[model samples]
Structure formats: C-alpha cells, structure tokens
Target: MQIKSVFIVEDDPSLQSLYEKILSYYGYTILGVARNGEEAVKMFVDFQLKPDIIIMDHRLPVKDGIEASKEILIYEKKAKILFASADKTIKDAALSIGITRFIEKPFDISVLIENIKELIDVKI
Candidate 1:
C-alpha cells in the first residue's frame, strides 16, 4: 500500500507530538505540523506536495479552524480535512464548509487511524 501523508493543525503541543508519533507508527507520513489556523492555511497553500489528509482542531490562536478551512478549500476544493475538535457545536458549520470528516476530541487513537484510512481510501 502507498504511504499516505498527513498534515496536523493543532494548538496543543502534547496532542501534536502524540499524533505525529501515532500516525507515523501507523505508516502515514507526517508531512508537517501547524500550531494555529493561520499557519495551517499558509502551509497548506505553500506545500510543495500537499498532504493527503489534514487533522484540524477548531479552537486555536490567531484563527480558528473553520475560517482556515474555508480559505484552504477555496484554494483547493478537494482538500481532505478531518475536523478533530472538542467543540461539538461547530460540527454543522464544519460540514457546511465541505469538511466531510468530523472526529470529536478525546477519541481513541485507533478510531482516528481508522478515520484517516477511510478518508484516504475515498476516491474524491
């Protein structure tokens, strides 16, 4: 199987590290990490080779995931982003903006891995 690449956008350092280690262990190439939504958008736009998936958090400094996702999607309509957030209220807003995957926070790592796999397997 071809190794899928992932981009992580999270503010918490511990979660970021954990995601990097866990996803890497699962054979997904962690392309890079962004600590804020603004940084995430900029990095995604400038990526020489865009990641196959993006794990995004809603609450962030500088900008929130929703706005950043809107910007990124405008640039790349098919960008696959997985909304990984604790804020349950924003699910509908996220989905409205074309983010098809939503994984609530405090989720099992295995679930996250499975979701990533499913998103990567999708032919969109």
Candidate 2:
C-alpha cells in the first residue's frame, strides 16, 4: 500500500519541524506530532490515528521509541518504523528490537526523503 500518512516521534523541535516540512512537501500527511514516546502512545491511543508509516527517534523521554514501537506494533503488526538517532548504541538497540530502517542523525534532507520514499514504495 502507498504510504499516505506518517506519524513522527521526535524530541528535537528543529528536526521535527524540518521533517514535517519535508514530508509534507512530499505529499505525505502528518498525522500527528509527539515530543516523546509517552506522548506518542497517548496520541495514538486517544486519537486512534493510524498512519501508513512512523518516523521515530531512538532516544526519547518517558519511554523511548523502541518500547513505544513495540507497544504500537502489538496493535498493528504491519506498522513500519524508521528509526533515527545520532548514537550507534541506540541504533543497535532499535535494530535488536526488529526495527528495519535506521537513519543517522544530522542527515541530509534529500537523503531522508529518498529513504522515506523507498520505504513507502517497499510497503514494509
């Protein structure tokens, strides 16, 4: 299925805004914004908002993305999660939890967009 909507779990405001702008430009709907994993879970549950894809940060307050993703995936097994982090340890942790895509922080916007497009195309 084509990824039309995306949920972003990012703690950094600047990066969050940049991602929102870039993804919106690509015609992907921004379902909601959460500053941390706790908020993300709350938003997902309260709104029952299901996005086609999820762009998550590895390090987050309250719960962290890996735990949140695990919980979210329990509800939606087909959930596609792309994790981003500056720390290799965090990325490794995410991967160990079965997260397939890992994007390094301070990434080029163009590269990020292309990766997102590719993930959406693959539908995994």
Candidate 3:
C-alpha cells in the first residue's frame, strides 16, 4: 500500500512548485497541482486520476479546502487529505470535518516528510 500518487491543491505558485519537486524527489508521482478548489475538483474529474493522498491548503479561492475535501470525499470516501494552512480558524474547520493531520505554515521540510510518511502509513 505504497502512496505513489499525490494531488496538491495550493494557491501559492512557489509553494506548489516546491511541494511538487520535493515530493517527486521522495518518489511520489504527482497527479496534478491545482491553484484553487474549483480547479482541483475539475482536474480530479477530468483526469480521473485518483491520488493515494491529497495535500491541500485550507484557504483557497472559488471554494475552501474543507468544502472541496468534502465534495471530493463524496466520490472517494477513502481519500486521505492533509490540511496545510497558516490560519488557526482553518485548522479548526478541518478538524471539524475529521481531518486528523495538519501542518502549520513555516513548517520544517524534514518534519513535513516525517508527517507525510506517517500519514501514508496509517492509511495503508
């Protein structure tokens, strides 16, 4: 149950690119990167690419991460989402939706890697 495919929903271009490159280095195949929830949903549908895990930003345009995650989960119940955000309010919202793992902004990359590894392990 290796986590090979991943989808990242983030608005910041630099962060998005950094995530992509870092994850790729760790041997995870990137399914796609979406700047907003709407684009995320559309890309998920259009590609029919079901990623093993999703790393999502809580604050997004068109739709927030919580809303997008719920919508995505409606179709893919086993979807594992990791919420990454700077806002405490967003963390609360994510927790309300039963999201267990969250990474605060300005996080250490090593810490993120460990967290991501643990998340994938739990899902498997």
What are the TM-scores, per candidate, against the unseen true structure? 0.97, 0.88, 0.89
Question: What lDDT tens digits, residue by residue, belong to model 3 across residues 27-111?
Answer: 8899999999988877776766688778989889999888888887767777778889888667777866766578888798897
- Backbone clash count, each prediction separately: 0, 0, 0
Query: Model 2, range 37-115, lDDT digits (tens) per residue?
Result: 9898777776566877789987899988889988777767777788888887677778777676898887898878877
Q: Highest TM-score, which number?
A: 1
TM-score between model 2 and native: 0.88
Error of 1 at 100 (Å): 2.0
Higher-scoring candidate on TM-score, 1 or 3? 1
RMSD of candidate 2 to the truth, in angstroms, is: 2.0
Greater TM-score among 2 and 3 belongs to 3
By lDDT, the best candidate is 1
Which pairs, if any, clash in model 3? none
Clash number for candidate 3 = 0
Least well predicted 10-residue stretch by lDDT in candidate 3: 91-100
**So what's the TM-score on candidate 1?**
0.97
Model 3 global lDDT (CA atoms, 0 to 1): 0.83
